[model samples]
Target: MARASSPKRKPSRRPWRRRLILALKILGVIAALGVIALAVTVYTTRAQLPSFDQLKSSPNGQMIRVHAADGTVIVSLGPSYGEWLSYDEIPKVMRDATVSVEDRRFRSHIGIDPIGVLRSVKLMIANWGTDRRIQGASTITQQVARTIFLSNKYTLSRKAHEAILALALERKFSKDQILELYMNKVYYGGGAYGIDAASRKFFGHSAKQLSLGEAAVIAGLVKAPSHYSPTADAEAAIGRAGVVLQLMAETGAITPEQAADTDPKSVALAPEPHQNSVRYFTDWALPQLDMLIDETNAPLDVWTTLDLSMQRAADTAIKADVPKGVQGALVSIDRDGAVRAMVGGKDYVSSIYNRATTAVRQPGSSWKLFVYLAALEAGYKPDDMVVDEPVTIQGWSPRNDSGHFSGAMKIRTALAYSVNTIAAKLGQDVGFHTVADMARRFGITTPIDTTPAMVLGTSEVHLIDMTRAFASVANKGIAVTPYGITKVTANGVTIYQHEVDRSHVLVAPYVAAEMTDLLQTAVATGTGRAAQIGRPVAGKTGTTTSNKDGWFLGFSSGLTTGVWMGRDDAKRVGGLSGGHAPARAWHDYMIKAVAGRPVEQFDTQVTLPEWQLEPDEESYFGQPDNGMFVDENGYPIAPGTYPGDTPTGPPPQQGYPDAYPGGTYPPDGSRTAPPEQPPVQQPPERLDQDWMDRVLGRTPDPDRRAAPAPARTPPPNDRSRGP
Candidate 1:
């Protein structure tokens, strides 16, 4: 009966209606709380942020650019800027492409695009449920705010800061000004920070000169620079540009026909200097800046010792010669140890490991330089007789690069031929301790074991260090600590200047001359003939066992260069030897490097005793019956004939009769004769201790010497067996 009565009354609807109204009130309160929270976040973020003017004129955004000796920009560190372009100067295609790809709703947004945020939320939900991808919804203004004012960290506070700054920027600047700032502050890869620099770096032109396709390619790089770098991976960059083109068409920025007509592949990238190989030098030099001055945000002008022309030459030579699966590195330094040119690897884009400065590989026969130097210091003259027969030291037997060894030969001849047994004997006689000391004195900072095999270059060494050692010899026995930065300037004010610092002489001048004599013979007719450059050249050739490493260390015309070729994984390269590839590369590089410079001569050639063969020894060594004897000066003379006596035979014939050239003999046997005496050319003006400062356009300051950064040491197991 009560139920019937209630049904008749139809249960007044007020209670349920009241419940609905209360629920609505609660929902409204929650929405109001959200709004208050967002307002507080914005206020707090704005309170901590830099003012718009501060962000616009920040010095922290400045870059460090390294210039070569001729004032050519070789590499840039930090953010690189080009001339700021006005809004009108930016190509319309570039603006449209960037907007289409970066933020389709950029024009309609008021600092933050609500519709875009909602769409992004929807897509994110869809992605979570259906495993689909979602694009980011950060508007261009938000990006500008983030880049200029906030860190890239993905925190709620950072997001709040980005939004607050973006809103503030919109209120303070017109839309065109905002866009101009965005374009001028955004980063495009390869060290480029602005649209103008990006255009110049990738397309070799100005932003105002971009075509539709080129603009699209550059716009696409904003998402990922290394992945889509045109100079790094052209195919990937072109594909990314195609996607940008499709987006342009979809956004009505370009017609479908126009997008289809533009081929991304048609975009030609700028030709980089030495394929940007100078990055190795910059990477090595940038770290030293911390030691020179206090940490600074202002832009720095780093005048380096690099020669752009020589760098190009080294890069070209390495690219034209290094075989596949093999990597090559070269380091060239002036007599004062200023690094002029450096090629770390065959292609820097493929590998960034700096072989010239960091990699430590075996010097093979080149290591013998220290051993022979030790012997020279131990009162052994170049003309002293040294037997090349089989010898053993400490149960380690060393073999000649050539299977056969001559019974007896002059010490210079033994070194020129790179006879391993003779080097081992010399190391034993002079003491490996002395050999190691000699190496250390010549800028070889790497640890050396006193083992017998160390004399044959079994110990590892860096190309830069070996080049520095040879540079000391070329500098007439003065020690050389290789340096790159000549001067550093910040905000147009001088901060640091490199001091001419060669305070120690590693060896006596006479000893260096004697070593130079042996090295000259090696290049003139022995193992290193392939390195000859029609001028007095001195160097040593090195080939590791199984052809795992090949090296050539030499100097000519006041430039000392060292070259190394090997696999990074220590795998063997077939048919690779120092005399063949490394020597040839050294020759090619030196020929171009010394061009137009006065063909300088080494110090007065040291005279050595002549080799007088026994009556039966010439035939015993398989010499021809009419064979000629080589006088003390390396000129061929009739048997039993002395110097200054006319030979009763055909004009000085080619080829050595008894002692053969070291390492691999030329297949053609054309290098049998000594290097032709080059017409003497005037030498460059003699340089004093302050010569480097003069060349670098700074006054000498002997009192202020900045200690160079410590040399990197390789692991103890980095040794390679010598041939």
Candidate 2:
């Protein structure tokens, strides 16, 4: 039987072949379906994606204004919503209106709406070949995908891509999430990128507070923001709002009567564009930030050292105090050498020149500090005496501005008075090269001539450099690199931070302390008295030859400030002197600039032994004074090994002349002997008795007998009068 069955099967074995053919057909059908599904997904995703050029060039994000902690706007960048919220912030009316107009069955559709698609197709066929109007059948998910992931082109390919993306988006997110994204990302005209901006631009309110009618109007603008913008045309927008209201009624979001009663007022355009307050500071700091960041194409948020209060104070002071025909600059730096405020010119817009840090003008007497410092380093004391007599140095004889010589003045008085003759003498004594070297070491990058005139401030320097050097003094001799920025942040991360460069330059603390004391005295009682702030302040004032330049450099507890006033063409202004205009400006600014800050004291205890000067008795008496014991140039030896004889009288006071047991001497070296003492005519006993009576507050009667005269002889004049 098996043999017969096998023969029959062999005769008609087409059954197995038929079975194989059926299996191949099933496989082909499955493969075809898979290809179709993949094709649909690829077409949808590609259509929705925006081109690289559009995304790069288009302004689609939020515009945010960044303000300081005290509300001074420092910068403005695009699209900073600050924080994104969920759909809960969306008003109920807005949500309902959006759903009704954009997608009637958004709650029911998995991703795409068949009814909406059919209606849209009918409208497309009816309006074919007419460029007047077109209908969109995009659900909430589809619109969100188009806005977030697609370009702004209208085509069949874009539609197909949108459909596929909508399906994917629906699967990934809830309907509410899709709607929220659509509302937040969709453009609503008039430079508004989202519903929030739209609401603010049009109604001056938030989307969360929109009325039902306002919600309907805004919902209608989504399809054609420019065409339906109330700011563009009131009639067309009203018509579009009617359509949205009808859709709401049809979708049961509102009743027919509710739709009819919903009326929205026209939107009012914003008045003008907004500008930030710290525009100048932002412009000034951006370049500095670029240098500090140093990363390739990285966005950074710079945290600067600008004190807004101080900046305002400086600006106000400049505007109020700066005279006409004169350009001035002010720079305020912290003790750490961070520039907090700066005004480069009277008006930054009128002139782009930054006078604060860029202008290099002759510092006048301001450079005297360097000269004094040089003298100090050379074992010279502040009390050391230097004659203010005129002298010729390298064929240049400098004269005192006061037009008179002050004979034999202490160095401190010479510096306080800004006496050019004394400064020139000190510079010559210490060597011009030594003073120039000291200036270089103190951060003066300017070219200082080795001529003796340089000691009288012939060198040019900028206000910022002066400020930094003075800040170094305030910082206790620590050399700090001046910086404008402190840190930079981006995307909640600190991308750049300033590393302070602090180095000690002065040889000893006493050197700086002694200089500070002298400077304080200058401010308190000398030429810089105008800079006194009723507080402990140290500063120096400088006026160039013929009052061409005025400068005041000073410091407080937390700040170091420098001010300069001069004509842009280097002409004299108002005959202004450093002790007048520049010092007054410095005082006015500093008084208010550091009103509430705690007072700080300078280092005053460090005693410098080499700077101490003792009087030479041998030299004072005009004796031989031992030329062998003195230096080779016949000057008193410094740190002299031998102690000279001490004077028998009291030390000389400030106002009184030295009591040399001689009467006034002539300008020449000749002196006349004093007249013989009048026979020792002692004071009358009655005179002494009257002084005692006055001290004891007792009145003497006119009849009281006079006291007897002393036994001393009367003068020859008195004897002649009696005879």
Candidate 3:
């Protein structure tokens, strides 16, 4: 026993090896427990997750984005989403900025970055119980999952859910697809849900139009939208954007010189509109969706013909001039019939009704365009003499707004002054049916009766239609079909394309030119002078009975614009006339609308008739003389008959020349009050053919008839001279 104890006395020196083995065993058990926990988390999250297809397809998130022809955003319905741009369609700068700022390892990661997660964990642990906030390290894939499927709540459960879905998405889609999805769904503050919307909301343009600074600014909003929003604090947003640019430079997304050359502060933010009048355009355009595309759950991108600059100009002009409680509408069209700008009402939020496309009102003297067109077609010249005396047609005696006629005057002067009696005579000479036919041919879809009052625009017509008719005249006889939607695309695939057959001629070129000459004279020296833009303008002024509606429709610089101001309830507006408020609005809008455009001259050669060249010394020309020198027969009297009258003072510009002596330039009201007037002719009551049915591309129902419009009654006083 002594010998055995002596051998056991030698103890082992490698005690460290036993400790190492124990450590290995503990690590292996811990690893097993971690693996089990991860498996459980994935299993639970997977169970609660929706299918990949379900997550990708946003059925209720249908957005109809209406864009201007220049790719400006007019408005969007439902969620504010940009077009779903593919990876290639997205600008490289936008992609690089987003990737470099949001996730550094986006390209190398497989849905989740292990190093990033570990770093985030280390940061969280180091900052625990401190004032420093914990930062997240979500890869782009994880973000896509959260944006498309998960809630925004910050919780361990949500993190687990996002991670599981991210891994699943990686397996299901390529990296590029994942990135595209993320870019299209990521929130960029200010109600914008994508790069496109953010670009437009902040820069007044599209995603494709984004500059390097703009791209960086948008990318910086990913961290905290409310914090980095440019609209909130531009300096802070620029600082964040500068940081993003630096990140991009470090990542080699952009060169150091490029970063140095970029100025984050140079980015201009789009001015916020006082009221969203563009909603009127979207409201008018959204109904066309059902007719353009097949039923689909995918979001739609509707490219329209709107000109955002012109729309802004119109909104500004209308708001500045239109009196409160009264509404105004405007429509501008290109020569090709593309609707550039549409302002349906002064304020869209107060009233959802669209006066431009839906509300039908009397056009007043503007309707005389058709009557004169018919007369011109009947071989009547502008210089042809027409008597502007009181006329009766079947117990209805139509009188001028001046209550007294100017006797005989040239037809052009008659139209320029909007002489109701002269218009009635022209209607009688051309036959009322012929005038009605002319109106129909010029895009007047409302039912026009073959009566004398029809010559004065007694029938109700949509503002858009009258605008289109005037546009047709400006187009030099080619019929113009006002269209807003140019095309529609869903999921980057074009589902509908607008096609136009522009070969149809509505009138002879010569006739159109003659009409243009007449309209030009009206704008140059007649009632529409208020709408002059120091360029070649051709238009007419219209004022309804009791000044219920004021209208100015004109064209210049290859653009045709029409303006109307009135109350929604059809109540009278005192002193409101086409030459005053409406013409002023048109002038303000057109001056801005045509600012950058080159001046264009009309192709007209006036052929003054023999009678026009050798006028009588005492002949009248519609210029009001206050009856100082003549009776109602336009005859000259002796000198000193009226206040400060001198018979030697060139006998005055005789006849009704748009203005009355000591009276307003544009005579206030026109047309006789209808003996049995009906309420403002409402749109057809048929469910299938609602008011919008008359929009572009719709075939008006042949049998559809408006209520029989009665003849207008002249006002009692002479001061209310027709414009």
Candidate 4:
């Protein structure tokens, strides 16, 4: 009874409560509407994001370029801008070919044909998840949108986006605009960007120039670029092209007879040459471009100073003459120090070791030019007399090549013959420190020893540096820094250009001229004879100790070339000499390089003095006495000695053996016996000094000069004499 009474009373207690309940019902409805609104906003936000087209045409897009040293164009950057036509401009056979090959439902779709979709769905379901062959139901418009505006992510969300974009694209543009955009944007391999680019790149013609068969082949690439690329597999591409033609006939796009009549020429695709003729020049130029621009996206066309023909000639020559398994490098530069041609190694693909600019090996006698130049700078003449005999300095004795004394010879002869002893003596005389400094001034970056041995090229140097040094001589002693890139243009604007700076290192042109003459002699008659061209040529041959390295550096009127051959490990190769291998390569390359060019000679007019040989001591001493003279005490004595024979006078020097006995001399000056006493040892008078100054120039500092006195011999009765 109490519960029933309380329920009635509670209901009657509140009118405001009823109003609150009504308000709660209205608020619940508003909350539901708000949830729906938020979901719609999130979906719309993602669907409207900018697509690939918008990003591609943006300001920060990547740039491309194709250029050569000479302004020849192989291809270009950006989309091909010709007015693109389809269905109508395209031959009916081509249109049908494309449709039959790419999409059979092209005409029946409103953006996408539902019938194709259902068919694809049924096939997929029947095969379960293992069937990728259930062809995509995307119509041509949808395909264009997927290729250009969306990625290949196969998900419902991506598909929905592609569908929406495709529908929007159809509304915004015509069917022709969509097809044109698709055809002009797809990749066709072989460095081609689009169908037009591909047509030209593969068949060497324009898109409009494609035959029915050729068009079919190009159309087949849309499904898979690599599989149908002519360069990748010619037979597969041809077969696929046949299928397209057959499909065209089946689809009523072409008559069977017409399809049979269209026979395209078999595509003859050539492998693209990996390197340009100016490979080294480009290698040198690319680094400079990196410094000047944001290389990753720089829109620059670089024009180099490389002469392509010369470069090709050089490459061909090296390939023809360089022996197998022997790596070599060749560098040729113009008088202005512009690199004309360079072969970094025997084969760049096999070995990227750019020996031309990278390998640093001993220059051998090639370095002697610096020493001779230093001597010339220090007031030494080319004809200055120096003894080509055994020399000892700091307990190190240097011997000639054959270990035979040549007595005194002119400096020119020493340099031409590359006599190690004479060069060492001259280097010691000229101050090794001066020679080292000269080497640096001549563009040698490798550290050179201040020892006399440096005169014989004991220092290491790169081929490039050696070439530049020889180029300097050809440039009349003006040092030219070698360069490759001439100019770089971007977007019709020159972004960079190279300007060579020529700094004069040698004050006297006559000195360079003299050195050039000596080097010329080396090429003509001495070690570098293999490098002799039909015309005047100046060069030096370098052979390292034990044949560890070989080098031939020479210059024509317009170009200077340096070639080096050696093992990468610095090991000696038996029977290899600079004059034989490297010189031959140099000669072959030069002959081809200068074939049609006019012969130009070095313009050095400085007269070299006549070479003179000093008299051997045997010519001064008479024949040894065999009882020819008697002492006051009736003792037999040598003809040239006094009767006492007490060894009190100056000890007798070892003279050439007398041909005749009893001091009897041959009537002719050619007699084998000792002829006459050479002038007695006396202080050099004015005439002697004049002769010395004329022939040997002023003697270098005594510390730098070879010892003036000849080696002493043991007295006849001395116990120290060797048997």
Candidate 5:
């Protein structure tokens, strides 16, 4: 024992004590160096910091007024604050909730918190590759530094700068002033910036009037504005508000019992996303606000191309005329594609879904506009024959809307009458792919099925695009981009001006004129007769097979209008045809909308090329692929027999396969034809006389040898001309 005690050697000279002293000295050196570095950072930041007096002239989010073409205000968009408030205007609850949630211990921190900085550093080290700041440790003063005094850079230098500036700010200003700046500078979601705008936008009042629940919910948005926005995502926002309330309670800003009693879901909100005029248009124009302001805070004016009078007309037309429980949309565009008027629905507040430019539905027969345009381009003339007879193509037999065949007539006549058979036949002749191409070339941005049904408008399209297409026709073949804004200005200085576009020319004047001529007849005497306005009008009526949708697309020289009527759920609108309510609505809106405007007419049509020659007579069944044969008079001969000629075999079905098991053409859409085979065993003298009379346009007299009327062609069944 004596030997072991002697070996203790003075307790090893208190090794732990010596190590403690050395460690304390190292800590003292680090602390002294850190204090010196921090003082230097503070001094440098103070020199670079902004003046507190600058707060009075600090930039505030602006309120913008959208003006119609007539200089009348359409809506006041954006931060609709009457005036910016000082820190005193913000309520204590609002401030307490913001400080508790956004930055707890905000009052105690000098610019930056060492504890917060340590926590933030730990999070950054743990999340190696992520941009996520697991915990935002920037004090309220630091946020103000970034917003007012420094750049929002995510770097060590930026953070150091932020901390120094924050310290300088705390030195120069009181806690309330810092809180005031933070409250007014933070973005609160929707287009709101600052507590005043956010308060007015969310709670319909100023920040001073906010309730505990409202303050908590609003404060939660400071983390991620759009994500936690009470008006945008109520569920997420309410949950975040509950967290804020709990934090506030834990911090002694509010009682634990009060926190437990407050239901975040009980927060009152402003009416769900509403506006004075069309919500769609206003919402669509929102992004333009940022593009125009460019850091200015003065009141700005946005002049749009909309014609308020016409907009009102469209709204009135939809509200007064659209059938009960059914929706309606109307869009009016000028030749320049200016959206003069647009009504997405009868009531925007009831349903904000816009049908005019967003909803897509089958266009029905109104699609024939493109089909006829194709046919005309392919050397078809208005006087060209389109026998309104029941004809089948590829097991798809088409007929007139009346289900009765109106024998051979001109293309103009067929169009005027809305004869489906002729449209289908012509579509096959010109080719369905051709029609689809022509439609896209004009203004139809919708997908087009290259099947035969497309000629009947089976594809879905929006009213605005369809109206835009018709507007193209009115504009003499030049395509126009639909635009809303004309000019944006502040203090009489133009901020933004729409560029004039001279591209997208799609059709030729001659082609458009021919189409116009044909469609004009459609309005005058055909299915579109109900759409006839006082002046020259061209339009087409559209009705789907099951009455699922109806449309009236028309144009005057000065304006073009499109109307759609249907149920939103795809239920059949029984007995509803385009010529019914849609046509009348179009007529009513267009007539008044264009009142007092100079009556304009489509450009004078240039001379059309002479009709192309048909296939040569020497050609056989497999002859040239130029469609059909032309007679000596330059008219295209229907595909069948001719006098003194014998068909070698069935001529390959020219356009589409003969849809019928076996159907024949009399070379002219008539049942009677000149002899091709041996004279049918002794043609009855009376029969021969009746045939000759019918061919010569003389009704056979009863007094003359009476013969039974030629067998009438049967009406096609549902499968023959299917819906």
Candidate 6:
């Protein structure tokens, strides 16, 4: 307290004045040092600045690009879109709109606009405490500096560099040259880097051909390419164009009448092209792009495995068949798994979901192929009979489409008829897990649940995977991995190439032939009958319960195709069955898809000689709970087979003997019939023992001399009705 009293009287005002003087000196030195530093920076930049020639050489640099298989430019993945255009090539309206909106005093300003910078500072202060760019203080020249020379930062040093560079650019190049560089270098929407690319992308015309409306739209995109892209969102683009038109008119760049008329003007967008089918294939291959780049970093000329003609066919077929709200996907893979054609959806612009490769849905009866293939592997034959009566497993009872049983039917008949009860019974005979393994072996990567419902197609899978599995059958059981890229080259030098890869045979040749025969029966008469293309085709039609989804999976000797139709929302399509739309659409598409090509039939023999064999008694009945038996032909009996004839029991079950499509006379010919039983009741078409003896090439009895190997004609409806 005593020191405070002394300080109050003696605390020198001199010390305060001296401190103020010292602070002023420090500030003066700082201002001088800042001016000197700025002058040095300006001198250094001017000495090292890139010349106009250097910039002109690379006015439109870009990264890699993508091309269609036919050498047409599909789309550019690079930073730049199309070729560079000179100022003369750029439309006047486009230039006017840009000047009016981006820099009103660009023509009169030396390098920087004082008023503009002041307004930008005011805007920044208004939006203080944030780093957001409220408004750019750069003039057109400053924009060029920021685009080509300086970093995109809001700090004072960065702004100083930008201003220095702009002055240097003005000293080195004419205003027209600077405008040309800006026009050719600015980024537009959809990978378009310049006015030229933006013009073509939005109007399907070059920059020189841009109309007032198109020019205004492109000018508006300068603020934000993606946000103002007409192709992405037309309403936003149109609104931006209106603002540009108003700016142009207010700045005396155009009359008010012109602004009114141009504001009302709408963009005349080009129609969606047919070649866009390549998008689906390219979208799939994009993931592999990064791994393909070499040390040169040059754009690769990648050749794909797409058949544009077939792709168009697939697209046309889907668009023609699918209803308004329903979506459909189609995949056509060659026997080698080359994805020749893929229609991921009815319209890709509406959705890029890629249903062919990504969307997984239940296949319904289409999954029976693997189930029946598993049955064949488990030693069940096409001719073996299974009771068509309903049965249950794990509290799951599946009924045939027709609730009434056909009593007893052959495995071939059951498959051709799509009898659900028999298929479920066969799955039980061959474990459901075995069925899943069969699918995996066939290149179905999607997970398969092993359960009673698996045979009924409860498992979900992508259409491409299903097509790949079916392609294995078409290619004689060799599992194929679907691939699109064939070769990648640059500067006429081959860099990356893909070799044909196929997995070991997962299905035996004989088993494949048998499966093909059964699937052929489906196309011949059953649910897939609509897929017939007047040629030998094999496939299955699948309609899920409640008709939520439909599928038609089919294959020729050369190509395998799968079609799927459903609502994206998973709502039921009510009356649309696989046979009605999917099969018919497949038939229509396949007819044209396979046209101008030779008709190559299946690898299997179509005649009976290949399948017919000598009957053996040991293969005659069921193998207990296994649900499979051997026929007289020494082959496993049908998946539908049961213990119909016990050999020593009462005359074989009444309807059993007639089920045989062969030449035997008695159902229990190897064993004597019991005394109480009457002669076996047989169909009228049943062959007598004397005729069977002749058909077996046996010598005729003296009392009833028979003809030579008798012509054993199966029932006329056998192909459609099953063996």
**Higher-ranked by TM-score: 1 or 4:** 1
Q: Can you write out model 2's per-residue Cα lDDT over 20-121, one digit (the tens) per residue?
A: 999999999999998798667755655664553343233454343344434455775544231233589888878888888877789999678998889888
Cα lDDT of model 5 by residue, 271-339, tens digit: 866553455566556565565446456678888888888888888888876667678998888777677
lDDT of 1 by residue, 122-211 (tens): 888877867465657788999988777665656668777777777766666677777888888888887888888998898887888989
User: What overall lDDT goes with each candidate model?
Assistant: 0.74, 0.65, 0.74, 0.64, 0.70, 0.71
Candidate 4, residues 1-723: lDDT per residue as tens digits?
565554344456467888898899889889988767644654563366455356234232134454555766423444333334453555555556667877777765656678878988898889896836666678777877776666665777977777666666655556665666666656665446556677777777667767777788888777777667776567678877878878888888889997788664455544444543354545555556556654444465767666667777777766765555567788998888888788887665455467888788877777787878887777777656666666766654555543367666666666666666677676777788988888888788877766545666767789999998888887778786788777777778887767777656654687777778777666654566567666668888776654456788988767899998877887544434566567778888888888877877667522322223222221122111111222222232344364322222232334433333222222221233234856345432222223332322233354443334433331222221110
**Candidate 5 — what's its lDDT?**
0.70
TM-score of each: 0.55, 0.50, 0.52, 0.51, 0.61, 0.55
Cα error, candidate 5, residue 190 (Å):
6.0
Separately for all candidates shown, the number of backbone clashes (residues 3 or more apart, or on different chains) is: 0, 4, 15, 0, 1, 10
Segments of candidate 6 deviating more than 4 angstroms:
1-189, 194-275, 293-296, 605-723
Candidate RMSDs in order: 16.3, 24.8, 23.3, 21.2, 16.5, 15.6
**Candidate 4 lowest-lDDT run of ten:** 618-627
Q: Whose lDDT is higher: candidate 2's or candidate 4's?
A: 2
Cα lDDT, model 4, residue 660: 31
**C-alpha positional error of residue 75 in candidate 1 after TM-score superposition, expressed in Å:** 3.3
**What TM-score does prediction 2 earn?**
0.50
TM-score of 4: 0.51
- Candidate 5 Cα deviation (angstroms), residue 105: 14
Alpha carbon RMSD to native, model 6: 15.6
